[model samples]
Each structure stands twice: as C-alpha cells, then as structure tokens.
Target: RDLNEYLFEPSKLVAKVTDIYLNFAEYDQFCSAVSNDGMSYNEQLFPQAIEVLERIRHPRERIDAFLKLGEHIKTIADQHKEDDVIYNDAPEEYIDQISSILMNDPVMLPSSRTILDRSTVIRLLLDNQIDPYTRDPLHMQ
Candidate 1:
C-alpha cells in the first residue's frame, strides 16, 4: 500500500508524524541517559521531515505546532547531553572501531563485516563511497 494514501489526510498525517517524532525523542532520551555521545537520530531526521512537511499543503498552524514541538524536543536533548557523563564501561565489541566510542546504534559493513556506529559510517560515506576498513565499494542498505 502506498503511504501517500494514508498521509493525504492532514489530521491523520500529522498524528502519524507526531507519533514517530515522539518515539525518536524517547529513544534519544534513553541514549542520553546512558552515554554522552553527542549523537541524536532525531536530529538527523528532523531536517528531512521538515522539508517534507513544507511541501505538503497542510494548515500553517499545524506545521507551526509541529515545529514548536520539535524545538522543545531538541532543547531537552541538548540539556540531557550537557548533563550526561561519559560512559567508559562499554565492552570492546560494543565500541565503534572508527570512533572509539560506545555504539548506541551499530551496523556492520557488508564487505568487511566490521561493526561501527551508524553515525560514524554515515559521516564516512559522505566523504567517500568506500568502506573505511576494506576500501571496498559500500552501499548502506
């Protein structure tokens, strides 16, 4: 089924998006409580979500309200990061090889089978299309 069908209704669409945003916010809070990694999956997706919302012909008030909520979530995330303590007790396998930090969201490189933090891999791929460890052509699935 095409998601566009369900998202055509502004009220339903807003509700779904808000639910997803809340879930991301909760996950970020959980991560912040455990580690001071300075990474947020919500932050990564906010711009994309905003761009999509801008293209939709939704009520201005709804968009504004969503933006306001997003800002509040970001503020809370920032505060959590500020007060978070560095976690140094992660097992070696749980650490990102590239960043040398605890991996909150880890992914394995298909070619090399090496595990690294999702954010680190994304940053690396932005600079080059090859895997850092194997220098092989990489595609993030």
Candidate 2:
C-alpha cells in the first residue's frame, strides 16, 4: 500500500504537468493569432521546464514524447525570431521583474504583489518555495 501510494503521487503530478504544458501551447497559439508574428513562450526558460519533467521516472514514454515535442517547438520558434523582431514594442510595465523580459504569462505574487513572468516564478519555486521578493511561503493554486 505504501509503495502504491508513492507511485500514485508521481502519476498525479505528471497529469498536472501535462495540463500546464497543453495550456501553454494553447496560449502560444492565441498569441500567434493576435500578433500575426512569432511571439511564443519564452524559449530561454523552456529547457529548465524540460529538465524538471525529465526527472519524473511510469509514463516514461509520455514524458519523453513531451520533451521531444518541446524541443521541436523551441527550434521552430528560434528560427522565427531570427527572421524577425518579436515583442520589441512591449511597454515597460509588461516586463517581468525577475527576467526583465517581456512577460508572456504574467503572474502576481500574493505576498509581495510583484508581477513576474509565469516561467520565472516556476523556475524560482522549483529551486525554493519562498517568494523571491517577500521571502514568504508561496502557495500555488
């Protein structure tokens, strides 16, 4: 029973990660449609997310597939950016506090009330649970 419970937790986590990945893809599609340009998720931080996913050890095939797809997407997006400028006209207010880049998916921290890119926050939280600005416990909902 203990072993079963332990295994079950990772499966649940995998499901959640998959959902987040799909949502990001949908959002990227929306951005592409509206901008008629190559704006997509921050390619710089994508590798970090993939590294996290690679650590998950059932569903090996599913995880591998995701990694493959993510790599392909990143490659294509990189090519597009090289051909044209992306988000060069973004306002200063739309920048992420941490990354200092144009925010693709901005999220507000409840404690510090600081706005940062979703990718930046996720990367920080993966290393530490505390909010970077306030140093308070961050509860992701």
Candidate 3:
C-alpha cells in the first residue's frame, strides 16, 4: 500500500516514526549535516524528520535516553571546529556556545575528570608529559 493508505490509519505510526528519528544513529548525521550546512542540505527532509520526532509523547525521553548520541553530537560539533573558530577568530558574541548541554554535563567523555574524552586528554598530556599548568597554553615554560 502507498503512504496514502496509512495517512488515515489514525494509528500511532507517527509516534513510532518520531521515536526512530529522535533516537537513531541517523540522528548524528542529521545534526552534523545540518550544523555544517543548513536545512537546504536535504531540503525538507530534516525538518520533516524533526517534526515526526517532536510529535512523540516524550521527545526528550528519546533524545536524552541515549547519552552517547549527545556525546557524539557534541564531539562532532567540536571536531568540526566551527565553535572554536567563532570562539577564537570571530567576535565574542559571534561564537559563544556551550559544549555541554548543561553545566553539570559529564565533561565531554564517557569518563575521567574532564568527562567528555578523558582518554584524549590523558593521551595528549602524557605525550607531552607536561603538567596541567605547564601545557601548551603556558608555552611549556
């Protein structure tokens, strides 16, 4: 049957579609694609997908349920360096952004004092064998 057949079903298909869109691997791609480009990337596909996800009863349940996805999204955004460029190159007001969703968000990793990516930090610090205060920022003085 075509989509028209289900259009009048009145079933909770909309909710289910929302659930998948909200909590799925594709979400990362969606976020990155949108962040890197815009709604024009896939035309109305992104917006339409978001609409379906929002129709769910508890959308956050799906979005927040998977912390890894958020982590990936944050990391992807960070790795893209868009925020960093704005924070550094652009005016202060031009690139202000919070990597962590909340002030208490687990750093940016699955573990460690930093939270977000403790291993990445540990590896970098260890490679340089420098103390926190004497790292690159201090010019390794």
Best by TM-score: 2
- For candidate 2, what's the RMSD? 11.2
Model 1 CA deviation exceeding 4 Å by range: 1-86
How would you encode candidate 3's per-residue C-alpha lDDT over 63-105 as one tens digit per residue? 3543344455556756666654644544333221323222222
Maximum-lDDT candidate: 1
Selected candidate, larger TM-score, 1 vs 3: 1
Estimate, for each residue in 19-138, the C-alpha lDDT of model 2 and write its tens digit.
Answer: 466456545564343233336455554455555556654266656666655666666666556644666577788988777767879999999999988978888888888898889998
| Clashing pairs in model 1, backbone N/Cα/C closer than 3 A | none
What TM-score quantifies how close candidate 3 is to the native fold?
0.25
TM-score leaderboard ranking? 2, 1, 3
Ranking by lDDT: 1, 2, 3
| Model 2 misplacement above 4 A | 1-84
Runs of candidate 3 exceeding 4 Å displacement: 1-18, 22-31, 40-63, 66-68, 82-141
Model 1 lDDT tens row, 17-128:
7555555544655434323345534665555566666676555665666676566666776766554344566569988888776787999899999998998899888888
Listed in order, each prediction's TM-score against the native is 0.42, 0.43, 0.25
Clash count of each predicted structure? 0, 0, 6
Clash pairs (backbone) in predicted model 3: 107-116, 108-115, 108-116, 109-115, 109-116, 109-117
